[model samples]
Target: MTYGHAHAEHYDLVFRSRGKDWPAESARIAALVRDRAPAAATLLDVGCGTGAHLVTFAKTFAAVAGVEPAEAMREIAADRIGAGQVHPGDMRAFDLGRTFDAVTCLGFAIAYMPDTAALDAAVARMAAHLSPGGVLVVEPWWGPEEFIDGYVGGHLVREDGLVISRVTHSVRRDGATHMRIHFVVADADGIRTFHEDETNTLFTDAQYRAAFERAGLAVTRVHDRDAHPGYLVGVKG
Candidate 1:
């Protein structure tokens, strides 16, 4: 789903206020890439939202770019990076006509794929853009067993001159997590509310492994903590 204009406008502020560690996450990803390809110099971020990771990645990689499909989100990302650096594309079918030393699909963006076929297609396309011996890192959504049905979560943030409240409820339906998020924003201008509904596909670990293996990449799952589903690291060649 395309993020609304207001949601995109406040995306960074809300997440930052919520204490999402963008720099640390980018550092971890860069370290993961260097572990496999010591000389990795270029990187591509698929589904890069607001280019928060890109800001830090730019400091580590000599060249960095991003692919985002949502126009609202893409515009914000482009503004953060550069208009020439952020391209308009989707994960399942985007061809930049160049390969990078590292490719990343984070924030559980892979879960946006509706089915296994799409997942395979997405992985294959990402792998196709990897240079020989390059690394692909994907942070996946919760697996079927880990997802809690009818879960409710909320966050409130007051930053600068704005107050933002976000509430979310999720349910597992037909092997997918259906979530409805409501955001309330109040500023000097006025108070407004927005709703975002998203469905994330629930793929098993075996399914993710198969997608990576079928793409001709050696893959491993790295679960860093107990609360979150971990990353899938794949290497080309």
Candidate 2:
């Protein structure tokens, strides 16, 4: 979520090059919500980066809205889903003055929380935005046991008369993953590079469950074969 302007501008392009299927992922989320709340008509996506999922959610539900903190990313999302649909707000404390039938925090946005305290606040806030019998789905970052230290990855894509390359190296430090990402983009304007140092907390499964339970939600964990890490589904009764 703390992405730079350059990073935000090309986020979708880079992810698409890395084979992220937004449509399919959005479909699965919609299915999960409908399964729990058959009459689900509204949805609110927290940390909705660039409105990729919101675009699909708008088609699936009668009403869909999103909350994003990053200005650069939020601007792009607003353009895609209309300015009124995407709001500027933080995940831990955002009030839209209304409730929805389904609330989702996807794309491992929870990992951005610095600690369990923030995680608890964020979950509680999302749950508070849900109506009776509403469902809350949260995709989590890799658990402590799943993170591999000193991991390296790279991707290169050539399209639209531009050549883009991205590389990343990650290490576990102080119960979190510190990722050093570098991007090189070349076009008629010449080549330019951008660097990002991002940290994602490695919260345990128990911590996730405890947060959901503390929010007064009946919670369950699920693994989507196509998505890494997995998701925690909670129902507000």
Candidate 3:
């Protein structure tokens, strides 16, 4: 399940809540768009959680919309970019009945797909919504070749007399990486704890490119040596 309904509320608090530089990330995305789609105006971001990208892209794009599957995430995104701009939907089969100059499925959204077939369907859906000459940028999950199994990490954050902590352990199994995360929240309301499980398909670059090509999109995959996991760029012709 995505976000577990309750996980969404605590997600920002535990993960991006502590000094996360959203502006810098948005700026980086903007720069990428400037290079690939300097003239692109209308953009659609699938799985746009919390609206940081939408708000920043609004500075450059004339019309922007976001598609998020989780209601809680959509509510927060609506608050950030207005309710009209954030739609309730998923990447696999969401169609707004209109096209966009740029379509993106970022923030490891593609990783959530159960398998490469689902990933292909999601990419095709994103490609279907792109206008001619439109740009498509997808931030993928860790390729099986690069993923380190049995990895573990944790974080802690304190705010408004409330403390939130999270610990995650990842294990690779049968072409998928299973991430088990546990969260603890302490405040005047009392102490509470919960855990969430996320499974990401270990899709390779070749698989992603094949999907894009099947959708009739010219593909280019680029990986950052130190920064991002990598992005699969496609252009609709």
Model 2, total clashes: 0
lDDT of 2 at 199: 91
Cα lDDT tens digits, model 1, 123-145, are 99999999999999999988999
TM-score for predicted model 3 compared with the true structure: 0.93
State every prediction's TM-score relative to the real structure. 0.98, 0.98, 0.93
Point to the candidate with the largest lDDT.
2
True-structure lDDT of candidate 2: 0.94
Query: Is 1 or 3 the stronger prediction by TM-score?
Result: 1
TM-score of 1: 0.98
Give the alpha-carbon lDDT of every model.
0.93, 0.94, 0.84
Pairs clashing within candidate 1: none
The TM-score obtained by model 2 is: 0.98
Q: Which scores greater on TM-score, model 2 or model 3? A: 2
* Prediction-by-prediction clash tally: 0, 0, 0
**Residue pairs with backbone atoms closer than 3 Å in model 3 (clashes):** none
Off by over 4 Å in 3: 17-20
